[model samples]
Target chain A: MPFTGKVLVCEEKVHLRRLLSLIVKSLGQHVLFEAADGEETLLLYQSVKPDLVLLDVNMRQRDGIQTIQALKQIDPDCLVVILTSLVNHLTAEECLRLGAADCLRKDLPREEIAVQLARIIDACFGDIPA
Target chain B: MNVSDQPSPMDLKGRKILVVDDDRLNTRIIRGILRPQGYEVADADSGEAALAAYPQFLPDLVLLDVVLPGLNGFETCRRFKSLYGDACAPIIFITARSESEDVVEGLAAGGVDYLPKPFRAKEALARIRTHLQNRLLLEQLSKANAAKNRLLGMAAHDLRNPLASIRGLTEFLRDGTVGPLSTDQLDLVNNIHDASQSMLELVNELLDVSVIEAGELKINRAPVSLTALIEKAVYLNNINATQKHTRIVLQTCDLPQPYLVDAQKIKQVLDNLLSNAVKFSPSGSTITVRMEAGANGCSVSVRDQGPGIPKDEQHKLFKDFGRTSVRPTGGEKSTGLGLAICRKIMEAHRGTISAANHPDGGCEFQITLPS
Candidate 1:
């Protein structure tokens, strides 16, 4: 399966978002949109309608897990991957149970990030860019 | 460690009693003895019936016949003790045999007291009353200890959140990342921020030691980039370094990749050590920091060209509030807890810390934290 569409990368910290966005772009995925928090994330998701979303679990107002719940209520086919620095088991389990595609801790190298994002994008779109 | 207002010991009302005996007349005799003292009484003819009565009657005390056939009173009492350690209400053994060995065996089987068949009813009642009193006191003491620990734990957790917030705000101020300030005011603010951070560090150390003493020191761990940690510590201490015209050089060896650890705690340890190095080293001298990888783990060393730690004082360096004669080179204030805190963090990480004079000159503080 190959994905040719875009991904919505939602994070709060400027440094983390910059580093992660570089990794996402290097993986050949288009950044359809970016949001600093969950409210912005929801509005962006509705407007962009990207193929996938990379979410930071700890965000202001509504968190990624709550945003995932809210998004699923609108679009059940949403593919959300939790992007977080802290990899707590409780959060990981909750994300998986709530229909997240997978969890990727922030410590991963750029290459691993690319590979993981590629897999997730392919899983969503059933194809990838050549 | 001391609770100013401790509660009084609890009191229990006199409840019912169950006396088990194979003989009907013997049971009657025991019932006659207890009935006069406000104790409602019941009887069971065998060990099986006595155990069955325990669940139904839920008696506050039990008198058992030691000679009952098939699951004797000794076995029944042992089972009762297992089900309830000191809180089995009160168990007294009554049997015809008065041999010293028989009495010893009866008490060993969880009988609070062994009474001869013709036991004095008044003495038996008094013994039962005393045992109940003791058990209530013990239960109260255990509850108090548990509550004290919980209160301390909550206070520490609550204190930490604000301390963290304060540290974050101070760091933002020191870095001038939040707003603008004049050169002199910036320096003043930096000093104030550093002092606040030192205070926060001491509070955190106190909380950590309390947690350790309470046997609640568990690491919340993650994979940590050693390079990143060193850089962050150096960045945090840059203000002091620039003030003294001193520099901390982080030299990287051909070490293995990053290791797993509690990054925040380990960062605190590194900051403590580096702060000490900067404080002790003379102005314009360089503080050398190097990392090395080993078969089991990794080690980080911070060396400063200052008067070395005296051999005699080294032994007491890690004791709480213990200070060495060596003062800070830049007139910096120390809480006298930095080394002790470093040792505590290393021990929690299942690692070790040591200080000694480097062959090149001055003293070197080394910490080997496990992966």
Candidate 2:
């Protein structure tokens, strides 16, 4: 069994989006919306109201932190996971404080998806079956 | 006391001179020697007076006597050193301190050269010329170091982002979240992932060292939230933390305020601190991370329950290639670059990082960055 909730995937890079969408589909989770950058992330959030968001930290127009802050401000319950390759402790802490659901390094194995998704879903939206 | 009376070794046609000595005779003698060279001269008989006149006079050189009535010559020289660092005009000690020991002391106290008792005015002029030339060379070296540091920082930054992107892609593919991955395939991915991460760390350290060399490296300054940074750092490093069965204690201040800092750089500093804490601590011991505000800045401290840093070796901890003889608990290969990078990053933000054995019998790494 996999996650059934609607998930909005936002990443600046194109290959990442395709890969992320594939992962969500494989996990039995719905890819309710997709965004290439921060601007699109925000716009999609309005129309899709995704139960989850996978956000790339560095993006054009608005950065990951600003986008997360804005989305949280709008919904107050937005589940946003910061996806960054350069995992500086200071930035990870900042994203969490700014109301990000979690901060995930982009380098984990595909097999570890369920474990990570479970942890984030539990951390942000409370312990519930995804 | 005319412009042509003194020896002309001093090319003071455009230079300024400050005469600092409590003795009326010494002031008069300095004036007699320098005035004739067309040098602008200002006299301050007291340390207090010298400080008051220094900025106003903007002298090209200072003739300080070692035995002043108050705030003696050594103290005056030290204050002046602080005022201008290595960039200011040379302070030549034209004093009556004739002992070899006294001469050494004067030079150590910031005097570029010591003209002992019964000094010829002509010789003093020659010594001043040499000091001025040396000072100019020292200033140029400092400028060069600053420029070098900036270039190093730029190189580090440029190399890091692409490495991160590559690491991210590797991570995305390895996780098997996009599809399914076999156990053997996953193991291979893990190895690749770890190697890339290690390379990433090395690249960061290289950048940090470059910044330190140039002395122009500083932490990015902005309003930062500590709680978020801490959680993220701890989480990222949790695997290592778990291997040691170490627990992390995070204590936020009563009124946690937003600190001004470049968040990414500070996080690197914090990660290094935490990594060191976990590395050195005994298994099952607790590592406490606390954030508090002080008179000058906000401080984050990582206290580890491990063998403390020996006092003798503490001074060299931040030096390039300076590593403690004590090895990591699990025989973890230390790049020996962590603390050096930590110090450089902290300094870039006008902050400081220091380590000490905690009173409770462990090691503590404390970082203070201005708010």
TM-score of chain A of 2: 0.83
Poorest 10 consecutive residues by lDDT, candidate 1 chain B? B161-170
Off by over 4 Å in 1: A1-67, A75-92, A100-130, B1-10, B14-18, B28-44, B48-62, B82-90, B95-97, B156-159, B175-371
Q: Could you say which candidate leads in TM-score?
A: 2
lDDT of 2 by residue, B1-371 (tens): 46785334534465777888887887787778777767678899888788789888887788887877878888898999999886567887766644677678888998878887665889877787676556555555677777766776777766665555556566776766457788888888788877767777777787768755766465567777877887789777767888888878788774356777789888888888888888887888898888888777778888988899888998878887688888888776577787887787787777899888879799888998775
For candidate 1, lDDT tens digit of each residue in A22-123? 666656637557778888888988888977788888777798789999989879998889885422447767888999988876644445666776776666
Local accuracy of candidate 1 as per-residue lDDT tens digits, B1-371: 35756545534455578888888888887777777766688889888888778888987778887888788888988888888776676788886755667678888897878777676878776776676566666667778766765675566655544444444444545556447778898888777766656666665566665565466666788777888888789887877887898998888775555677888888988988988988998988988899988788889999999888877888878876788998999788776877876788788889999989877788998999765
Least accurate stretch of 10 residues (summed lDDT) in model 2 chain A? A105-114
**How good is the docking of model 1, by CAPRI class?**
incorrect
Q: After superposition, which runs of candidate 2 have C-alpha atoms over 4 Å from their true positions? A: A1-3, A13-33, A56-58, A64-77, A81-118, A128-130, B1-18, B23-43, B51-61, B78-90, B96-105, B108-110, B116-122, B171-198, B207-371
The DockQ score of candidate 2 comes to: 0.07
**For all the predictions, what are the DockQ values?**
0.05, 0.07
